[model samples]
Structure formats: C-alpha cells, structure tokens
Target: MNRTDRLLAIVLELQGKKTIRAEELAARFETSVRTIYRDMQALSEANVPIIGAPGQGYSLMEGYFLPPLSFTASEAVTLLAGAEFVQKKLEPNYGVHAESSKAKIEAVLPEQVRLEAEQVRATMRFFSAREAEGSRRERENMELLRQAMLDKRKIRFHYAKTTGPVLQRESTRVVAPYGLAHIQGAWMLVAACDLRRDIRHFRLSRMSGLEETSDSYELPPDFNLEAYRPRDDRELKVILLADPDIADRVRESDIYYIDAFEEHPDGLQIKLRVRRMEDILYWVLSWGADVTVLEPESLRSRVVKEAQKLLERY
Candidate 1:
C-alpha cells in the first residue's frame, strides 16, 4: 500500500479499540521504528490529536483525525457536495462510504465555510434510484471466476437455458474461463469450452453455482472476444419508429444508426439488430406508445402469435 493507504490502515487499526505499538506499524508498513515516529509527528502537525502514553502506544483524541488526504477548502466542498448527492440516491453499500467522506470533509472544514456546507447539504438532493446490484453471493462467485480465469484453472457449473431444463455441466475437461460481463439487466459469464473452443456465453442468474479445479487451461494466442460475438449471429432484424422522447438514449449507443431514419407522421424510423428476439421485444415494449416495429414480418407475426396465445390464457 502507498502512504495514504498506510496511514488509513494505521488509523483503522487504532480505531478498533487497541493501542498500536510504534514497532507494530513499522513492521506492518515495512519501515523502521524511527520512520514511524516521524510519521506520527507529521500526523500531529496536521492537527491529528494523537495522544501517546508510556508503554501504552498512541491514541487519537475525539474530534482529532487523520486526513484521507490533504485537501484545500474548495476541494473539500466539491468532494462533500458530490458525496452528498451520492448519499441521497445510492444504497448503503455505496452511500455509507460517502457518509464517511462527508464526515471527513466536515472534520477539517474551516468555521466560516462550514455553515455554507451545511446549508448546501440541507438543500441538496440527488436524483436516481439505487439499482438492484449484485448480491454478496453473486459478488463472491464472480470474484472466484476471475481468480480461476487468471490462474488458468478449469471450472464447472450448472446452467439453465431459457427454453430448456437445467443441466449439470462438466465443462472443465475442455474449456477455460475467459471473462464475465453484465449487459442490459443480465450477467453473462463467457468462456472457451475446450481447446480451440468457440466462446460460449452463460447467464449467471441461471447458473446454479461454480466449481474450480487444479487443472489449468490455455487459449489460442489469436483468441479475441469479438471473434466469439459474431456480428451476423444476431438473428433478429427489426425496423422501428423511435419516439423523439428517447432520442437521447439512441445517441448514447452505436446500435441504432439514427441518420438512417426516415421521417414518419409520429416519429423517426430506426433499424435495430438483435441476437435474440426476447430482449429487444422487452426493450421495445418498454417504450409503450412511443415505438412501432416497421418491418420483418416474422417478428411481427411472432408478437401477434404470442399476444393471441396470452389473450386466450387470460
């Protein structure tokens, strides 16, 4: 760890309700005891209320603190403002850290501008809701997959295809884990299933769990992820009139060629490509009255067929 992290670790270690000996910090930071003393002196010069006792080591007094890093007054305000916005909109996992940051800024803020910060914080609010992110299990599992990929270990897992039953897969005999990706609303783990194997994509939500083995695997030197995701394999072709309301979103991704549009009575016509019909169908349906599929008789037919079947069930 660098100097900033080393100091934070020292404070955290002390915060856990035990005096940390100078020698202990020296050993932890791989520095000499005299260097640690000099660091302590530096901490004190920065207004850290570190009280030292004979044989009892050192402790920080209440209201005294270690700087996350040295900051100018303007920098502190900017940091606190951004963090305050994040604190309002994000979940505890994200916002709680922002809270600590806010406190750190408040700790060193000068008396004159501190009230201004309070006023700003009192009036400020952040937009955007906390998205449903990965669960702890999901995060741990994903980390394991990353380690396995780097170590070239073989991995196994159960997978459920959308149209089929779940199957217990023993892919380690052939494949090597390559990468994990989250797109749209789903997470996909990509891998090469065998030597010279084509890249395969698996849905994480549909996966039961993962297993890794001691065995290592290798990929062809020329392997690239784009080689696996074929530009042509996108099976569904679509044409639509995009609602002007979501034109900004269209501008965000290269997926839709906006200039290719033709003016319609309602909106701009757009062409879209899809590897699978379901996802794009859901996406289009999300726009409600704003979008209409213009071409590809097969896709329209399938939608109508599904709607008819649903009506009967209803």
Candidate 2:
C-alpha cells in the first residue's frame, strides 16, 4: 500500500486494540520492524498519543482518541464515485445501504471536499448490461444465502429450473452454500447441491421459499472457486464474426467465454470453447445481425432452425 493508506490503516488498527506489538504490525503490513519503528516515531512526532513499553509493545495513551478522519478532495471524489456505482447497480438493499453510507461520509467531510464529491457524483454514470433486475424478494434471499455461507450452514430452497421451451419445474433443494457472485448483471449462488451430487450455480432470481437449514457443512479443504469454474465437459470449439460494437459488448458481458479474439478490417473474429449451444445461439441472436456464427455448420443449422421457429411463431 501507499504511504498515506498505510498510515491510515495503522491508525485504524491502533484504534481497535488496547495494544499492538511492533513485530505484529510489521508482519501484518509486510514491512520491516525497523520501518514500523520509524512509523511509530513519525506518529509520535505528529502529536499522536502513542505510549510504548520496553519489550512489550505500544498503545495509545488511556482515554486518548483521534478525531474523525478527513479525506483529500480527490479521495472523497473516488469514494463517492464507487459508492454511486454500488448504489446504482448492485442489490436493491445494498444500493440503499450505499446511499446511507455515502450520506454519513458526506456529513463528516469538509465543506470543500463534500462540494467536489457532489459535483463528481452529478457528472459520473454507470450502465448495466441487462434491463431486468432482481426484485426485493430476491435480494432478501441473497442475504439469507450470504448468512448461510458465512455461518457454514446448509440452506433449503425451492429452485425453478427451465426444462423446456415454455415450462419450468420447482423442486425442494438442500445445499451447502459456498459462495455468491454477480455475473452479467445478475446474482448467482454457487453451492454443493445434495440432489445433484456436484457443485452447481443457481440463479438467485429463480429461487423461491428459501430457508436456513439447521445442518452445518464443512468446507472442502481443496475447493477453489477459480479452479471449479470454467468447467466445460462438452466443449465445442466455435467461431464468430462480430461488429466492433457487439464485440465490445461481448467483452463486457459474461455471454461467452472468449478463447481468442482477432481484429479484422471487416469486423472482429472471436474464438470460443463453449458448453451449451443453445445459450450461445440465444446470445448471438440477441445481437441481431451484428454477430454471425462463422463455423460449426451444426451450430449454424440449429440457429437457422430456431429462427424458422421464430418466423412460424410470428
């Protein structure tokens, strides 16, 4: 971390504890003991009430507390910008929390810094890939699932899975909640499904009647999320030619796993190792004429058949 951030962290750490060993602080910050000593001296010189005990450690003088922190104008702007994005794009309740937290921060900031932050907020914006959003019920479900993950507890919920063109089925599931992620502007829960006997990703929006289970689960010792994901058993190598505008959108979205991308005079050529052909076909169709499946005649034929079905429906 930079010097300013490190100094702030040290102060916060000191505020939380009665005493801290110099060695402990050094190890935590990945710095040398000598550097920590220098930092303590610097804090002492700055009129901070740091009392030291020989061979013991250091502590703030009894009843001594620092005043509320003041942020630089640029720092205030950066913080406000991040909070604005979270408020605009994240879970509904989380967005509300962000707004409340931003208000608290602004209340403590200097007038000039607050004014600058407000100006920055007024000018900056963020956009989501999809227009549809999770309802308040979905956000509540996310909080329950998050609590389950934190407590190492199992969760029971009814999951609705799409089985056919116009049908879905709801079934009760008891799962060991592992993690939650925001992918492609939606929330998904990753868990070890007892019914499936494997790790699976379930869309939070599709879950209903969630309940925390009494059972506890032990986390697998060798489980790694990054390693567990990008799992494709039936990998199909395919290619696509995309307009520049659509290629940019693809890069920003989790619509496809791009293995390689090449720029050309006509457009961009994208190579991918995909799992589900139907998902890929629908994603390409969403781009309309901006994207073309250039290889794998089977995929092309499937898209054509789907298009024909659409024509018949119309």
The model with the greatest TM-score is: 2
- How close is every model to the real structure, measured as TM-score? 0.48, 0.73
The worst-scoring run of ten residues by lDDT in candidate 2 lies at 128-137
- Clashing pairs in model 1, backbone N/Cα/C closer than 3 A: 174-194, 175-193
Superposed on all Cα atoms, the candidates' RMSDs to the truth, in angstroms, are 12.3, 4.8
lDDT for 70 in candidate 2 is: 85
Predictions in order: lDDT: 0.66, 0.80
Off by over 4 Å in 2: 1-9, 13-35, 41-68, 85-96, 126-134, 150-152, 163-170, 220-234, 243-254, 287-290, 311-314
lDDT tens digits, residue span 49-145, model 1? 7788889788878665444555555566688888976565333455789999788778777766777667756775655433433333444466667
- lDDT tens digits, residues 1-314, model 2? 98767776887788889899999999999999999899999888989889999988988888887655788777887877788778765657778899988888888998988887778777877764444444555677887887788888999988887622323477899999888777766678889999999988898888888999899999899987766674566588889898977767777765446788889887888888866665467667777778888989888898788789989999
At residue 75, give the lDDT of candidate 1: 65
Give the CA lDDT, 0 to 100, for residue 37 in model 2. Answer: 90
